[model samples]
Target: MERGLTGRYEVTRTAEEAVRAFVPNPLPPEPPLDLSGERQRLLEQALLACGRLDGVSALLPDPDLFLYAYVRREAVLSSQIEGTQSSLSDLLLFELDEAPGVPFDDVVEVSNYVAALEHGMNRLREGFPISNRLLREMHEKLLARGRGVDKLPGEFRQTQNWIGGTRPGNAHYVPPPPADLADCMASLERFIHSDPKPFPDLINAALTHVQFETIHPFLDGNGRVGRLLIALMLHDAKVLRQPLLYLSLYFKQHRAEYYRLLDRVRQEGDWEAWLEFFLEGVTQTAGGAVETAHRLLALFQEDRNRLQDLGRSAANTLRIFNALCSRPIATIRDLEATTGVSYPTASKAIETLSELGIVRELTGRQRDRVYAYDRYLALLNEGTEPL
Candidate 1:
């Protein structure tokens, strides 16, 4: 049902032109979401997928190994939507201080994404609530050392900001003017912390994500932070044990439709359409994550079997293989530190793996060479091409 224009637009003057900036209403869309028939089925599937995704940790001997790469994969995909060009390998190489020709700023943005997500997860584990304060903290880490550093990292925008065009006059969307931010954000927080709980966890997350994006609270990292809010909210609400569900790939894949639905919710008051898309993304992404965990577990076991035949050299070689499982890209020194072996032992293990074709050298250089677990990365690199 089209409820028509979800919020009022306020006329605001900017440097070059005047525009009607949108200030969105708070959560629990008026008239309530119609979650009765097919919508109910979608929500049930999404929640069930999340339940399986939450228990996917059981599929791995060490879930962090998958989490480590999976999170970076998400960072790359998320940043790519904002026009960053860094790949998963580029990020891993950057963390090792060995990405000689990789785009520095792009990789920094992806790395900061990893750090920001970890910070948010850590804060949640320490009993912090998801509020404006924590969102600011995550935004701070996200822009700590990227192109947006000058855009005021940890604070909400104090000036008008628009999306898509050269100026607010012709922009695709203009978020709320600065003056409305405090009240808007506080209302959003209240919705999140409502005593009776306005909606179920999955529904609440969908509503919160849209409201936060409409608010567009931050100066530079709103898109990234808004995407992060979904994962954070799901994890905080006990929908998932690990902060693993990311819709960036889904949004990136269906870029046009995603934007259209967000606009529809604002203009036609079609919350049901947006919620349908959001639930589908959750179901697809969560199920995909579980499938990935299974594939990785199988890959690890297959690779271990391949190495078990190495006999005398298998001991040290398997140790390095374990390290590679956690980090698919590593230098000799990185493996050494991770495996607690001497430089020579790590180097020889690398040499043996090189001969076996289990790992390949990234750089042909005699020194500062990097190696990659090619097949493992191949799995994570799916659908991560820059948009």
Candidate 2:
């Protein structure tokens, strides 16, 4: 609708020079959003896809098994957008604590993402509201160790920050000045907790995402935390039963368009365009998650059937295989502890699976041998290649 510039810009001074920093208005865009016709159809499709994704838990023995791997996949992709080179295998290998020569800084950032995500979901599960306090908590965990440790992890920035250039004067975008950050975020919190919200939860989420990004609340880890906020918002609103919908892969795929729409919302008041893109991403990502679940279920069934064809040793072999499904990468010691089998039994079972081409040894060592559920990791690793 080209209502106008979404917010006012103020000339703020950086160390080098002066720049125009943006202060975005709160949620529920003025003159309202135009969700008629095509936008409405997109919204319905997105909600239906979300419903299907929520029901995918029915296909799994335990949803946490999928979530355990899926969340790490998300962490990898999200950190990649921030220029991290960590892959899914790197993350799994790190979690296994056998990371000898891995990319420590990149993998550390990705690992912190997993921890931050888990913290938010756990708090939500414990009936905590989605508020600034929760955002700060997640940010604290996000920068707990690696790269951005000195940037004040849990607190909002008290210094002006700019994006995409060498200095604020030449930066492509400048967020609100430090003095206005608190008011901007407080307005965002009110919109989140508002009863009888002005828009549907899906639309509300899309709007909140843009607002949060524009605010650039944290000095570092703003991009990662903003992505996490989407999953957190939808789950808290009861829009999804689980935190299964992630847009990191989608945003990473259509990154140029994602940035363009964010700019349009700020420059021309084009909320409709951004809503359509965000809604399409929700539908596409949710559908992909459900499809992945089905494929994993089928893979387990097919492999188990193959094991059943064997004779007396099938019982114990199947036991270790079940444990492998939960932790696709593990040491024989890990498999032994998880399945309560002897070291010899665990070794023998893994050897049997290796003969069947189901498991591959990661480290060719006499001791501390690690095995991978080859096909399973391949399935989860799709679209997670680091940029």
Candidate 3:
């Protein structure tokens, strides 16, 4: 299965230095993927996991509550891979207009990711094609604020870029130079449109992700954007009702191996190895998401049942509890606004929940107190212990 070099490299001169910039061949590599035996088994497992995840979403009373929090968790983890130090809690705190203890720039990066992802998924749901234009739109939102603002946010890079080194001289890999971008990107666009032949959705996504990484279209946020493309493709193909299958956690956990496999595809024509890894990631990530959704659903039901024991306070207590299910952490003011109840009423309800050990107060203060849904947050915070 070793077909070799996958694509040709161009000898380009940048800043009085010569470098070999890789221009990857388009999708549906010659001699097709070897989907026999183990590879076929992995593909089947991934499809089954995705099917199970889809079932979970369909059965949920409100999938958006899970989607809302899950997407933000992905944003935090995806940006973490790009060296951002923000955590999922930090993102929630930031969304609530509270200061996240992390650096302002780091939180902004994660926040932008959330916005960018939402934009892409919304556009796709509206019947927009996943082409270069949509990617540009996503890139615009991704670097809309903070550190990446100066990195030519929406447009493809017009200058040479390198990865893993100070300059092209010692860079780990140099992407296609500026002059070759148009042809390179156009070929990529055709592949995305499934010009000649169409691969299955999961296989198409795996191929597209690697090609985008090699293309490294934007000046910055290539890695983040490439990862986003996976969710977008899956959703577009109707593989999942919600954008719930994120592989960033798996990729981040296996960081070194992930990069190595990507390189292996380019250097050696080892698509089978990378495909195997990707399938495993998809299966593991999808199964994990299904488990988390079920656990969260069960926890919410159990806690709601427990709240029913609040007797006279049960009616008002249930209202606040529902708000916490959506926002896991809330201040009295948050519950008040969300539940449309008065301040004193919200406070008493929170006090009742706290007494019942349903909600835990985080800040030890007499005023401006904040409360967390305790076990609910614990379930979401699993595997998200920050980098």
Error of 1 at 287 (Å): 1.2
- Model 3, 142-169: lDDT tens digits are 9999999999999999999999999997
Best TM-score among the predictions, by candidate number: 2
* C-alpha lDDT values of all predictions: 0.91, 0.92, 0.90
After superposition, candidate 1 runs with Cα above 4 Å error: none
Best model per lDDT: 2
Q: TM-scores, in order shown?
A: 0.98, 0.98, 0.97
Clash-forming residue pairs, model 3: none
> How many clashes (backbone N, Cα, C below 3 Å) per candidate?
0, 0, 0
Top-down lDDT ranking: 2, 1, 3
Model 3 vs. true fold: TM: 0.97
Error of 2 at 325 (Å): 0.6
Q: Which sections of candidate 2 miss by over 4 Å?
A: none
The better candidate by lDDT, 1 or 3, is 1
